[model samples]
Target: MAWLVSTPSRKDDTGDRLFLEVAAEAARNERIRAIYLDVRAQAFANISRAFAGLMGSDAVSDEHRALAQAFMLIELGSVCARTLLNEPVQPASDRLIECLVGMPV
Candidate 1:
């Protein structure tokens, strides 16, 4: 089951903001980690969308590319956390990274 925490004060869609808030709170509860993992996976997907322009070899917006990197880092961190907890690696992790690498930055 997913835990719904109230949104913290923030002004960006960097994904790190949400992950940090979730991780900080989840650190106190093992049961909540799975929900955080799910959220992190979603964040990875959101970040992957930034490559839309780059896919066509068009100029990508700096904002989108930067946000994408932030999203990737967050996903990587979440993967490490899952590994530490002995949870199965999220299946989309490699695929998402592959997409990132395939896209033009």
Candidate 2:
């Protein structure tokens, strides 16, 4: 769920942030929670795989490897949050992508 993270901000009729409003709505819905849980589980599995791959690589420096793992966790949280709101999955920002791929390793 990258769309929500990338979406422009707006104010709701109640003058509250639209993103917060949507998040609150999702929080109240059981179906949305279920979907979020499922997605979160999958995200964690993916992160585990990536971490394992990184651990096996001798080329990656410890600091950069740790950063990469942290980045995966951050991305997982972001995706799960967006999934809770049923947002479309969009590509992550180019800068973030670059950091994930180009970080000294």
Candidate 3:
């Protein structure tokens, strides 16, 4: 007797790009990327209070939250530093990188 197939194998699927994979997963699942962005924003808005709440819940891992908080502060410092220098960091791309990769003062 022949056995029945339960799950599809790689041969049965079409390849997807990185962006497509992320978009498709976000579309089909509840845990979309947008939700993470929103939660991360809220976490920063009230970090002292939210940190306590975040510690109590499991929606976001504690380590990830800590990293995000540190990154947020770095971004804030980059913006403030540029404003003070009067260098007029006109192009937004550089500012974005500074926010993401620059160190906090």
In order of appearance, the predictions have TM-scores of 0.36, 0.37, 0.30
26-103: candidate 3 lDDT, tens digit per residue = 677777778745755785655434333434543544554564566455444434434434333334434443343332
For model 1, residues 1-105, the per-residue Cα lDDT tens digits are 011011111123456455566777888877788787787667655554545444553444665566466555645555444534534444444444555555445
Worst 10 residues of 1 by lDDT: 1-10
Clashes of each: 0, 0, 0
Candidate 2 lDDT at 58 equals: 37
Ranking by TM-score: 2, 1, 3
Tens digit of lDDT per residue, candidate 2, span 19-101?
34554666999887676667655755554455445546534355544654566554544445454554533444334544554
Q: At residue 46, what lDDT does model 1 achieve?
A: 56
Clashing pairs for model 2 are: none
Clashing pairs in 3: none
C-alpha lDDT values of all predictions: 0.50, 0.48, 0.42
* Residue pairs with backbone overlap in model 1: none
Off by over 4 Å in 1: 1-21, 57-105
TM-score of 1: 0.36
Ranking by lDDT: 1, 2, 3
RMSD of 1: 12.7
Give the poorly placed runs of model 2, Cα more than 4 Å off.
1-24, 57-69, 76-105
